[model samples]
Target: MTSNKEDYLKVIYEENGLERPVSNKVICEKLGIAPSSVTEMLSKLQKQGFIEYEAYKGSKLTSIGGVICIKLLRSHRLWEVFLIRYLGYSWREAHEDAHLLEHVAPERMIDRLEAFLNFPETCPHGSIIPKNGELFENTQLVKMTDLKVGDIALLVRVEEDGDLLDYLERSGIIIGEYIKIKEKEEYEGSVEVLQKEKSIRISYKAACQIYVEKRR
Candidate 1:
């Protein structure tokens, strides 16, 4: 199968979380592709035995599809580790480059790269890197928007987007950093949080995309 086809499987597998079927609309939004394009690809993927698609219900990955998705994720996250640790690439840059490099890099090269990085358990953005035979599952994660004012939480994963990543970087929103919600602007649907003694205000939409864990 083409890498493009593999990419669609990976996205569906990841987003669907191996638990529920994901709608084509969700896939279209994530990939920024047309709905018709998504429909065509879903049909192709179903015929290729990678997924089972239901017209209005959604789609789910088959067993073989799950395996391929894990391999792609492993390669992508391992490359992120390499780019950040040895190459001096920031989180945002590493993610952007890794997206392209993961498709072309050989399995053997990725294996050695994994060892060179000392088997990192997670990527730069705190996303778990799946080891061989392991399935990636997120646990204990809550959206940043869910936190009430005066609550403290740990920044865990920032959604993979250049603008969002850059904004988080400038606001010092690194993984594992503690942030406290100081205020919520209902009028604007924005939130203000205190991080490292500074206040940063972000939109509710952006906050919803940020995953965090409540701190004690």
Candidate 2:
């Protein structure tokens, strides 16, 4: 498959297309492409039986498309783990290279790499790595925006955007860290969180992109 096709599948899956239809606007925004271009591609994917597309309602992956998407995810995430754990790359530096590598690497090489990495469960950004084309679901995850004041949660996964990753690293928001919501700005929707005794304010947009598990 072409890299563009793979990217479209990945974006759709990441946006939770499996659970519901993902709008053309969302796909266009994620890909930074024109709506007409996305429309063309979505039609192509639908005709090819990789997606189910509706004119205004958007699209979702079909079974075969999902299988291909999962395999690509497995390769991409495994590459991220290997790059960070063994190659001494920072978490923020691993994504782009891993994305490039995922499209070219063979399955056998990915299997060996996963073995060499001792089969890590997640990438450096805390997104789960699929195993044998299957993803182990995490049902407890909630968006960081869902937390209320005084609620504490464990940072689990973060959106893999370069600027967001860099901001998170600078703010000491690593995976597995415990964070307490100290305050909420009602007007703007930004939040103040206390992590390791230091207070940090994150924009609502940023909060929405972070995934956490509420601490019991």
Question: Among these predicted structures, which one has the highest lDDT?
Answer: 2
lDDT digits (tens) for residues 117-136 of candidate 2: 99999988988988767897
- Lowest lDDT 10-residue stretch of candidate 2: 165-174
Estimate the TM-score of every prediction: 0.88, 0.88
Name the runs in model 1 displaced over 4 angstroms: 34-37
Which RMSD does model 2 reach against the true structure? 2.2
Stretches of candidate 2 exceeding 4 Å from the true structure:
185-189
Residue 35, candidate 1: alpha-carbon lDDT:
92
Candidate 2, lDDT over the whole model: 0.89
Model 2 alpha-carbon miss at residue 190, Å: 4.0
Q: Model 1 lDDT vs. the true structure? A: 0.85
